[model samples]
Target: MSKITTLPLGFANALLVRDKGAILVDTGINANKKIYEELFRELDFNPRNINLIVVTHGHADHFANANELKEITGAPVLCHKEAVYALQTAGNSAIVPRNELGKSVFEIIKKNLPRSTKKVNPDIIVDSSFDLHPYGVAGKVVYTPGHTDCSLSIILESGDAIVGDMLVPSFFTGEPCVAYFANNEKALFASLQMVLQQASIFYGGHGGPFTKAEVLDLL
Candidate 1:
């Protein structure tokens, strides 16, 4: 059985999936490394045991520490092919607002968050669905887009999915909602539908482990 653990890094979250080895989904921000290290220790997982680091999107909060984690774990980093440019340029990848909330959030992020320091070159660039069996997980990485043009989701055979910002829990109500910031609303809806067909439990960067029923109601 695969063990899934949610590693909440303050404002964002990362997932640690353990099968025969470990697969880390997202790396949070640069400053969250110590927190991740501590969590790994608590879970009795050695950083060296990590076989792969998957970045769900190119957002600073999601891929900021990917290179660092890869260095520490001696694991290769993987991301959608389209995200490579953003990661290499340390750019925000041109986020387009989908709603009033998205606009407000984007402005706040622009004002507060700094660009990621180091440029990350993905070791494996995926254009379509990629199997994870070689990495010791019974899952695959699927292009899910919408939260960003290169968003990807990790869907496990057990029906749990690590869907970055495509869906998030409301900060105030903790209800499942489409992400506060999305580049394309229509694409986000379609990606959510695609994920819904494959996953029963939805995990998000902001909050979740939401049921399929809860997500359906939110949609």
Candidate 2:
């Protein structure tokens, strides 16, 4: 069995998936080392034991502290090929509003829509499914773009998936729904359906480890 722990940050969460070693997915907005150090102590995990760091996408909220964490844990950073430019430039992919709330929120934070982080070139840049067994887990990072062209999801053999921003809950209602900002809703729905077909639970950066039933209703 694998253990998925939510490492809460200010506005989002960085997930720690423990199997033989551990895999960290996402690093919240501008997260610092002290936060993770404290979190590691609380979890009773060695800070240096992170075998891999998977940035679910090129969003600042997800990849912000990746470089810092890599320096601390000595873990290899992996991202999709499409995310390379954003990661290398310390930039983020665009956020295209898909709903009324999205439009409102985007307007409020339009200037900082795609937040910035310190540049960190990924060790592995894959355009196709990448197996995680080499990193001490039975999982795969598959392309699942919609929220962003570079979006990716990690699907574990244990029926748990870490989807970046592909599935977001409403800011007002907190109900599971499609992404507020997506490059293509049709593609997003297809990807969501694909993931739901395989994994029983979905973990998103902003919200939850929602059950399949909850997500199915969104579809």
Candidate 3:
């Protein structure tokens, strides 16, 4: 059976899927290397068995360890071209960092936390939406901009979505409703509509794995 395992790292997360072999989605900051190694070894996956490593977005917490893992697993890395640019520059020119003025002080504080490492570009760059079937995974890259122009999500054949910081859980604010904002509000809203149409379960960068109904209600 195919499965997705989340590797939470504070405000960020990585995912591991067991389908036709193990595919790791995103690799948290490189400092968490030992934890990842332990997780993979426990799952009986020899490092090289990892077929692919996809960086959902360009945030350091989500991609700091990508290069390290690629060396150990020899897996090709994939992400939207914009995401690649963001990672390669380490938020030096990120649209998200440049557009956080609208968020509350608390949110801005959370967004400014120091990152762990320098950027590393992905091996494969996805400019537009595309199918991952050629790579053996049953999913597609859905361009869901807003949080960042480079922001994207992986929509599994099962309608499960791995969205990076696109939307989060309601409980985060100790409130019944949640909030959504993007570096590009126009693109963010459009992307929200985009996901609303296709996603069944939203697995986000932060607190989530929310049901479509739950996410819709938030919208």
- TM-score top scorer: 2
Q: What is the TM-score of candidate 2? A: 0.96
Residue 214, candidate 1: C-alpha displacement in angstroms = 1.0
Report how far off residue 72 is in candidate 3 (Å): 2.2
Worst 10 residues of 2 by lDDT: 109-118
How much is 54 displaced in model 1, in angstroms? 0.4
Error of 3 at 176 (Å): 8.3
For each candidate in the order shown, give its overall lDDT on alpha carbons.
0.83, 0.86, 0.69
Q: Per-candidate TM vs. native?
A: 0.93, 0.96, 0.84
Whole-model lDDT, model 2: 0.86
- Tell me how candidate 3 scores on lDDT: 0.69
Candidate 2 residue lDDT tens string, 1-219: 677898878677899988987889988774688878888999889968789999888878888878789988999999988898888888878778988988987888777564655888899898979988888888989999888888899999999999998877777788877799898888888889889988999999988889998987877
Give stretches of model 3 more than 4 Å off. Answer: 92-102, 105-112, 170-181
- Sort the candidates on lDDT, descending order: 2, 1, 3
Candidate 1 lDDT tens digits, 1-219? 577888877577778899987799987663555766787889888989889999898877788777778777899999898899988887766677677766766677777764677888889999889999999999999999788889999999988998998888764567678887777778888999999999899888778888999988977
| Model 1 quality (TM-score) | 0.93
- Estimate the Cα RMSD of every predicted model relative to the unseen true structure: 1.7, 1.2, 3.1
